[model samples]
Target: MKLIIRWLLLACALVLLTQLDSGIQIRSFGSAMWAAFVIGLLNAFVRPLLILFTLPVTVLTMGLFLFVINALTFQMASHLLEGFQVQGFWHALLGSVLYSVCSLVIDVALERLLGPRFMPPPQ
Candidate 1:
């Protein structure tokens, strides 16, 4: 299904990130894959609530606070997943940026190759 494809791409992105940066580490592909899934889930579900709660701060910061939220979510995912570790706030922030870029690249490539039909329905 579309969800599975997205998760696979996320897993690939995470694997690529771990290889690119020493601050992020995944001991096994399975753990990386699971971490990707959990991260995606947290972003999809928990992140919005966080954004809403921090709306004032987000607006005050002109949306820059979202980066902090993203980093926190990345750290939360790392904590939830065994064999996946993010060193600190800086590492988490870097990892979040890297993950976003990698995921966007992977998604764009997959969309071009497989067509837009594989994408999840817009929420």
Candidate 2:
């Protein structure tokens, strides 16, 4: 139940990102939902690994490398999923920024409205 709501929120975030003039497109609600799930999974599993592997560079760059990693991950997810397309690296970077901001806003609103019972505590 909570998972479903979170997915819905993420879908909304994707829609909002599309509206932000970012080159992130989701052809349908189903695609958006699936892409959200895939992005969540990638962020949970792959992101940490990438962060760990790039720790030295991350440190050297004063955390700027994380933004690059985030954009790359977004592009990778776009590549893996059908019906979701991000044009180029710049587009992916813009999409990543939009996605992050929109998701954060949506998550906060959902948390406040639904409370912790409907939203899992942040990991």
The most accurate candidate by lDDT is: 1
What residue runs in model 1 are displaced by over 4 Å at the alpha carbon?
118-123
> Could you report the Cα RMSD, in angstroms, for every candidate shown?
3.7, 3.8
**Candidate 2 stretches greater than 4 Å from native:** 117-123
lDDT of 2 at 85: 82
lDDT (tens digit, per residue) of candidate 1 on 1-123: 555888888887898888888889999889888999899899999999999999999999999999999999999999998789998999999999999988888788777777797456578
Models 1 onward score TM values of 0.89, 0.87
Instruction: Write model 2 residue lDDT over 68-106, tens digit each, in one string.
Output: 999988998899999888888888888888889878777
Clashing pairs in 1: none
Clashes found in each candidate (C-alpha, N, C closer than 3 A): 0, 0
- Please report, in order, the local distance difference test score of every candidate based on alpha carbons: 0.89, 0.85
